[model samples]
Target chain A: MDKVIIAQNLSLAYSKDETIINKANFSIDSGSFVFVTGASGSGKSTLLKSLYGALKPIEGSLVVGGVELCGISSKKLNFLRRHLGIVFQDYKLVKEWTIEKNIMLPLIINGYEKSITQSQVDSLLKHVKLQHQAGKYPLELSGGEQQRVAMARALAHNPILILADEPTGNLDDYSSQLIWNLLEGAHEQLKTTVIVVTHHIPETIKIDYKHYHIEFGDIHEVV
Target chain B: MKSFKNHISLVIALVSILFSLQVFTIVERSIDAYKENLAQNYSLVVVSQKTLQKKELLDKITTLASIEQLSPDNVIKKLNTGISKKNKELLKVTLPKFYKLQLKIYPTPLQLQRLQKELLRYPYIVKVETFSNTHDTTYKLLLLFKNVIFILSLSIVLVTILLIFKELRIWQFKHNERMSIMGLFGAPAWLRSAVLFRLAIVDALIAFGISFVIFSYFSSSAWVSEQFANIGISVIVFDKVYDSLIMLGVSMTVSVLLASFIVLGHKEEV
Candidate 1:
């Protein structure tokens, strides 16, 4: 399988004088559903952020989708992001748009035709069982419902890699299971690479997968 | 392809405000000029040699509070010098110092007409006449300059409105940057900026429309007609549709591009 992400001696930090993830190294395969588990401020989200191109590496090399994040053209980074789907802990859906519009946003940005985008959005909305709530706004929906909509949106463009930051953090057990099931569905069907940052990974091991828990400010694959 | 009339109307309102200011100023200046010219040109001229009759006419004139006393010798010299009136105002003719005997008056054309008839009825007044003549190219030149000043004033007003719009757009740029809030589902910068420029064009058209109406109102007034006589007042309104269209296109293009850049450069919320 092709390497979807690579980090070599990747030191991530907010400032020059400090290093949060000190010279870390990691790689994610194209079809892996990897979970990054750590305590609060253990650099779990920061590591995930570096994999995409939000924060730059302070001292080392990092690459995503063949585009070097440490020193890459902004255009190429945008292109890489087009193939990448990201979900924040907060959902980040525009409150003004309907659930259907929200779901089709990525496809629209990727410049898909309206009819095809609608079909894709329809199937995804039905897959997440949000067909009745398609016309509703983000604030109008419950947290579980909103998360499902977000999941659908992330998968709308059918990206090769999907990153989620504590997706089920604030959800109840039932909602958490539902979100995990949605991810599992996407991963299994598309063979899509999935990287999830979570502190609840130990209890979330419902499926066999590789796990990395933060210790001493670095990712160490649990034995 | 929205007919920018709406935006143009709004711009017209802003421009009209400026033009109205210029109009008020022009009216005041024109009034001042009228007053100044009346004061400079007015006098009790006795065109007859009947000394006693001249005295009686002068006496009758003094009875009216609006009239003043006059000297016989002074009156005779002025009536004789009337033949060389053009050269006298030219300040090059060797006319006697009776030019200093002139008195000032601020009367409406009706009042002046009455005065002309009253003075003409006097036997001492040979042929009562007014020196406010189109043949006096000096006054004509001054009138031309006055009109030019008004045109320049209107032009300044227009430029000021355009400048204000520019300033507002600058503020818009900073606002978008500071907010860093994306418009919505991948809407590009041009669509956002186009909304703003369309508003500006509407404003310009609105201002021009209102100014044209008010200016037309003043132009049609009887008083204004008397002031700006046919062929005497050179009112060449320098407004060609194509010229304005070219300016509008350039400004709209520039504003659209500026808004696009500003929106695109804005910091997106993390």
Candidate 2:
């Protein structure tokens, strides 16, 4: 299997005085589903941020899709981001835009034609079961609906990898089950590499997935 | 409707500034035309013992456009009302030579004084009367009016520019989150800022159109035309095409520059 992300002795930190992840080592193979579980403030989010070039590594090597995260230029970072999808815990959907436009954002940024972008957005709307709410703004939708819209947006451009941070953390049981099923479907059907950050991993997940736990700034694969 | 209300204050501020500027330009031109009309009718009376050539007078007073020698027939005719022919002839011979000295333009009080002193240097010249009292008062009043308009226009422009900038900054803040999300999605800087530029362009056009209509109506108004006629000078209140083009340019430039400033500031913070 090809390695999509490789981190050797990576040190993540917000500032030089405070380190979040010290000497962390991890590698994620292509087309694999993985879960990162940790307690509050255990540096799970920081490690995910470093993978997308949001947080810089204070020390050691970290690479995503052959691009180094540490000391990356803004132009190079943007280029790297084009090949990845990120789902924030708060949904991060543009409040002023309609749900359909929000789903089309990544496709537009990737320079897809208007016809293609429209069709893609329409398909994603159906996939997320929000076809009726396509014309509504993000603020008009429920938390579950908004999160599903964000997920559809993340998958709009068919990116090589998707990094979801606590996607089901704030959802109800019904929305959580729907999101988990969507992630499983994307991983199994489309063969997309997915790394989800959460405090709990559901035991009912039937697909094969690797689990990593973080504690006291140390990352270890549990199974 | 909310967006329109949000942008209305900025549009009004821009329009006020632009209208003041247009009024200032029109008033300045009108005053210039009035000054030229005054110059055409104004001249000084000079008495000289010796016959003076126009060229020699011009050499001595560079400000003098021409000198016209006045005939003594008017004085002779007045004295002849009750006198004999010989006495009238003698009165004519004794009368001093008078010449009307025309000026190229209306002179400032200081320039008039300098001209008087320069004329006094000639041994043959005796009296020079410029009617300084009336000319000085008129000139001073015109200058005071022009300065007041200029200062008022400047104040309006300065205040409105600050207001426009503040309004634009608010708009920028309102749109910053959306722009940042676009940036994270790999949108280019220009793409992220497209909405701001569009807003600027649209507002500029609206302000330009409003100002153009108002000025056009003023230019054709009876009161405006009557005011210029009263001063004995015909002035164009505004040049429709040329002046509007200039106003359009100013409106667009100010709006675009302010929008760019806000966008650049947002980028730096992000």
Candidate 3:
């Protein structure tokens, strides 16, 4: 009954001259795993951006975790980010910092003390099976490894919700299953609300997860 | 940890600017003090004659405003007596009867040679001369030594800043990124203004501290500090007070202006 994300008549667009998705509507329940599927330009990523406070809605309303997304200030956006975990298909890790430091970025920006940052980084690294690679830089990590590291960093501050946009879009089958297992494990163990945007729906995994396909520029749940 | 390491370069840059301004103020103040002493003690001559009618010469010399100071008439009237008085005071009197050269205009080093030409024409006048009264050669060499020290001090400072800046930029970029984001986050305009205030105060303190130490050091030296000390407490206090204050005020104002420019460049979009 509780909604983690709610959008009513949401219209997303880049400019006044062009509108991509107009009068869109969606609601995602708390602690539920869902897929956001669409053709190449059906606005799946755009929808995900709106959920995590990236793109502002042009002419409709959107609420994520009780905070309005449209026209939100950067301060509130950062505050909203504290409760959110975002995993990009292309992991946006700082090239200069070590893997551990990259994972600790959100914490550092938020001004977390030095003493607790180490122990916190250690626990998250172990959770993501990345404890050994903590000393390496982002450039040193493979694509799959970098994504996992991004996942670990996103989860570092114990965010309430996780939004993964095309998490397995560029991964091999083995790496893909491993990533799904990690996402599933975090959700089941921590009861974190997770939304995953993926192209492939592998049948081997047994879990109660909803599937939503984007068609005719509208989102519809499919069995 | 990330924020701590970030902005290392910015801090190093700030410290370098601070120290450079410090040494510059010192060297600059010393040069200015030398120039002032050269002007203040310089005398202007209306009449220089071995034999002249005293009452007639008096009418010729009193009209120049720049000639506020003249030798005690005893040097002209009781010339024999004035020489004896100076002889008893100077422990190392180089000459028994050194002509008290009257300066008709303030002579900069370049213009001082004209005194040579004029003295040559006046066959009786041995040489037109201005003498520094102190025994210490250190003050005479103050400008040269400070210039050397300025170069040496800045070389060390630049090298240190280069090393430090390299390490700091690693962390500084991220710190700056987050800070810029924080401001763009619509961190109340008032808070960003607070950062400006912090910048102004730090720059001002640096300028003030440097000027105090620099002015004190150069002023304490017996040869160069004569103007700074005697003018402050003695008869010329009013004459020199404006210059001393101007030196301090300019240093503070310029440093604060530089800091404001840096802070302005960092502000976020409206």
Candidate 4:
């Protein structure tokens, strides 16, 4: 299988003197479900940021979906990001927009036709079990329901890679299980590479997956 | 209700700007029309030793509208009867040719002085009467009025434009989160800020409509017509098509430019 992400001596930082992740090297194969676990401030989220072009590499090289993330132009970065879906812990949905519209964000950005986008949103709404609350705003929904909306949005565009940064961090048991099932479903059915940043991995996942643990600015795979 | 309240500040700013601009146009046009009225009645009388050619005189003084030689019969008739027909004929012959010089437009006191000097340059021209005392007072007052109105209108326009920009920036800040989310999704800058531009355009149209109605009512008001009549000049206070187009253009340009500035600032921050 082709490598979906390759990092060689990668370093991530927010400022000049403070390096978060230093000289880390790793690669993940296409269509693999991978979990990145680390302590708070171990740079797990920073690593995921680099994969989606939110954070640039301060040193060395990082590549995702066949595009280099280091020193990338905004236009090229946007193009790369279009092929990737990102889920945040806080569920960054436009609150003013309806949940249905929130799920339609990716498709709209991808320039999908209205008819197709609406149909896809309708099906995704049913899949996320929020079909009854299509016209409601994000704030009107519960935390779990909102995260499910965010999940449905991430999977809406059929991205090549999905990056989830503690997607189920604040959700309840049912919501967390549903999120896991959705992520697994996308990985298996769509052949999408999934990289999730979390502190723990659930024991209920029934699939072959890889695990990389970040410690002291270094990433190493666990057997 | 909330959306209507949001549009208030921008709409007010646009209205003040457009209203000031229209007032400036009206004042300028009224002054011009009044000057036209004055030019019709204003003329200079010149006594010359020799007959003057219109073309040659025009070459020297370009403002000359028309020159007509004043017949001397009236003055000759006014003379005493002690002068016989032969003497009267000789008196008329010796008298300098009287010519009235009208100008194409009303001249300022300084321009009239310059014209007097230019006319006296020719040895054949003896005396020129410009009635400067009366002309000076009226022209000075008109000029002062025009200057005052121009400064007032300009100041209003500048301050209102600043306020409009501030209001637009506030609107942009309110929508910043939405725009940033769109940007993260690979939407281009223009597409992400489309909401700001749309709001600007919509507010501009509202301002334009309000301005048009206000000016239209003011233009047709009987009091406004009476005031123009009192001044003895006809001024076009509002032109429906032309003025509307200008107001629309100005409001659209200012709102869009301010919105674009806000969008650029947000982009830089991100």
Q: Provide the lDDT at B3 for model 4.
A: 79
- Per-residue lDDT tens digits for candidate 4, residues A1-223, read 8999999999889997999898999999999999999999999988987787777899999988889988999899889878888898989899878999999999998999999999999999998899999999999999999999999999999999999999999999999999999999999999999999999999999989999999998999999
| Candidate no. 4 TM-score | 0.91
Model 4's interface RMSD: 2.2
| 3 or 4, greater by lDDT | 4
RMSD of each: 12.5, 2.6, 10.9, 2.6
Q: Going through the candidates in order, what is chain B's TM-score?
A: 0.36, 0.88, 0.41, 0.91
Task: Give a tens-digit lDDT track for model 2, residues B72-152.
Answer: 998777666688888877877777889999998889999999998888788888998899999999999999999999999
What fraction of the true Cα-Cα contacts (under 8 Å, chains A to B) does candidate 3 also have? 0.03
In model 3, what are the clashing residue pairs, if there are any?
B5-B171, B6-B171, B6-B172, B7-B171, B7-B172, B8-B168, B9-B168, B44-B103, B45-B103
**DockQ versus reference, model 2:** 0.53
CA-lDDT, candidates in order:
0.65, 0.87, 0.63, 0.91
* Model 1 per-residue lDDT tens digits across residues B192-246: 3544555554555455555555655765567766664542442322233633454
Highest DockQ model number:
2
Measured with C-alpha atoms, the lDDT of residue B244 in candidate 2 is 88
- Native interface contacts retained, candidate 2: 0.51
Query: Ten consecutive residues with minimal summed lDDT in candidate 3 chain B?
Result: B231-240
TM-score of each: 0.60, 0.91, 0.59, 0.91
lDDT for predicted candidate 2 compared with the true structure: 0.87
Better of 1 and 4 by DockQ: 4
Q: For candidate 1, give the lDDT.
A: 0.65
